[model samples]
Structure formats: structure tokens, C-alpha cells
Target: MTTTPRFKSDAFEAIHSAASGLHRSGVVGKQTMREFDALCLAEAPHFDAKSIAAIRKAAKVSQPVFAKYLNTSTSTVQKWESGAKQPSGIAARLLQVVKKHGLDVLV
Candidate 1:
């Protein structure tokens, strides 16, 4: 993330910061902090097979290596690239991060 995340507004950032402080001070529980974290996170955008392949290529990694970073199987990556299936949930979100911040961030 940057100084201010693109996903959240200034108000959300302020609230999140306060929630983070509360979390650190043990004033807020992990569950509440997790809710705050979810509010701050952007929903993963849908990517077509071409876009998925391009992102992988741009990272300069093979399917197996990319799969390793994403904690998924190489065949899953292949399925995504071939339009046989699509990435969802965590994998999709990780792809968004890789697309925006580069694959190095995940490492």
C-alpha cells in the first residue's frame, strides 16, 4: 500500500488508523480490527483470461512459480489462463496486488 491506499477514502483511512491504534492498545478485539481491515481493503476486480495471462507474464514468472506465490496449484493457474476457470477469493485479491504493486510485494 501507499501513504494512502487507493481503495479507501481519507475518512476510512482515519477510522482505520484509529482502529489500528485501538488494536495495538488492546482496546479493540481482533475481530473488530478484522472488520476494519476488511473495510479498508478493496474488492478484487474481475480479470479475463487474457488479463490474467498478461499479469503473469508481466511478473516475469512461469505458471508454477506464480502458483507458488499465490499458494495455488500450477494447474489452477493454467485453468485461469486458459479460461477454464477463474480466480476467486484470496487468489483474485492476490492477483490484484501483484498487478498493482508487482510480484515482489508478495515475497
Candidate 2:
């Protein structure tokens, strides 16, 4: 919470308000709920390759070690660094958490 958020407070507040209205309407289906859960899990900070690499380097971990910490493969880490692929789903969110809250969240 020490870091300033990327979003403006009013923008975030509006988004939350919309979500609250949706919930109040009781129109959220099971499929919608599942999708929402996925969104929550993968709410990435939108880091690019350089940023991703910086984070790993900052953690003082090699690619393989970072992969192990993420329960993924070094190849995936390489792909992220190379921009061959973007980290998605839970992995992206986890990285965001690490960036904001420190790497200890994985532990």
C-alpha cells in the first residue's frame, strides 16, 4: 500500500461501484462468477519482459529458481523474458503481488 496505485482513485471507485451494482442485481450467473474468479486470480500489474526480468533479478533468483518458486518451468520464465509469451492467469497476478507486496508472498 506504500506505492501509489497505477489507477486513479475515482476510476477504481467507479469500477467497484459497477461491480457492486451487478451483484445487487443478482444477474451474475455461475459462468459469470467463474470468469470473475479468474479475473481476480489473474489481475496482473501488466509487467512487460523487462519489468519481469527486473523483478526476478531483484529477488536475486536465477530463472530456474524463480520458476521453482512460481511452480513453473524455467522455459516459461524465459518465454516471459523474451516476450514469446505473456504470463497469464494466476502467475501474472502472483508476480503483481510480488512486485507490490514483496516476494515473501510466495513463501
Candidate 3:
């Protein structure tokens, strides 16, 4: 059998601490963490405009109400639902969150 290499927890902690220092020195804004999260969601395979719209409809919520819940505009929701437009970047990520968590996020 082939052996896998593993590092100790302290080594990982040290690397993390060094990266945090670089991040705090104007090398990286805390915003990058949020951006990275957005990227991950955007890269997630399951998100699509149709799925987002269907989720809202499935929840039996009106377009305006759903938009308000998502902190977006009614027209935007309509565009997404009708396939007249598509969400990109952070908007896509937010839709992914809404899909998984439901409208309770608004509350």
C-alpha cells in the first residue's frame, strides 16, 4: 500500500497564522473571504436560474415577496424566473443560499 503524507495540527496552525498576518497587512482584505465564498458558490454545480425560480415558486411565495426576501428588486426576480436574464457573480451565490436555506433568511 502507498503511504500518504500528513502534517501535524500545529504546522497547519502556523501556516494559517502566517497567512492571517499577510492578510491583515493590506495584502488581503477580509472582503476576500466573502469573495472566495461567492466564488465557491458560483462554482457549485447545482445553481441555475431555473432552479432558483422553481424553488421560490415551490415555496408558494409571490415574486415581489421573494424579491424582498432576497433583498433584490421584483424585476430582477422576474427576469431570473422568466429566463430573460441570468444572475452572475455574487447574485448567483445569493440565489444558491436562498435555494438551500429557504425564505427564513429574510426573517
Best-fitting candidate, scored by TM-score: 1
- The parts of candidate 1 lying over 4 Å away from their true place are 1-43
Deviating ranges (above 4 Å) for candidate 2: 1-43
For candidate 3, give the lDDT of residue 56.
88
lDDT of 1 at 63: 98
lDDT string for model 2 (13-92, tens) is 55645664687788666577555445433244577999999999989889999999889999999999999889976798
Alpha-carbon RMSD, each predicted model:
6.8, 7.6, 11.1
- The lDDT-based order of candidates, best leading, equals 1, 2, 3
For model 3, the superposed segments whose C-alpha errors exceed 4 Å read 1-47
lDDT of 2: 0.76
Q: In candidate 3, what are the lDDT values of residues 1-107, reduced to their tens digit?
A: 66332223555545555655778787867887445334332242345567877888877899999888777899998888777777765577666777778767658
How many clashing pairs per prediction, in order? 0, 0, 0
Better of 1 and 3 by TM-score: 1
Error of 2 at 75 (Å): 0.1
Tell how far residue 21 is off in model 2, in angstroms.
Answer: 11
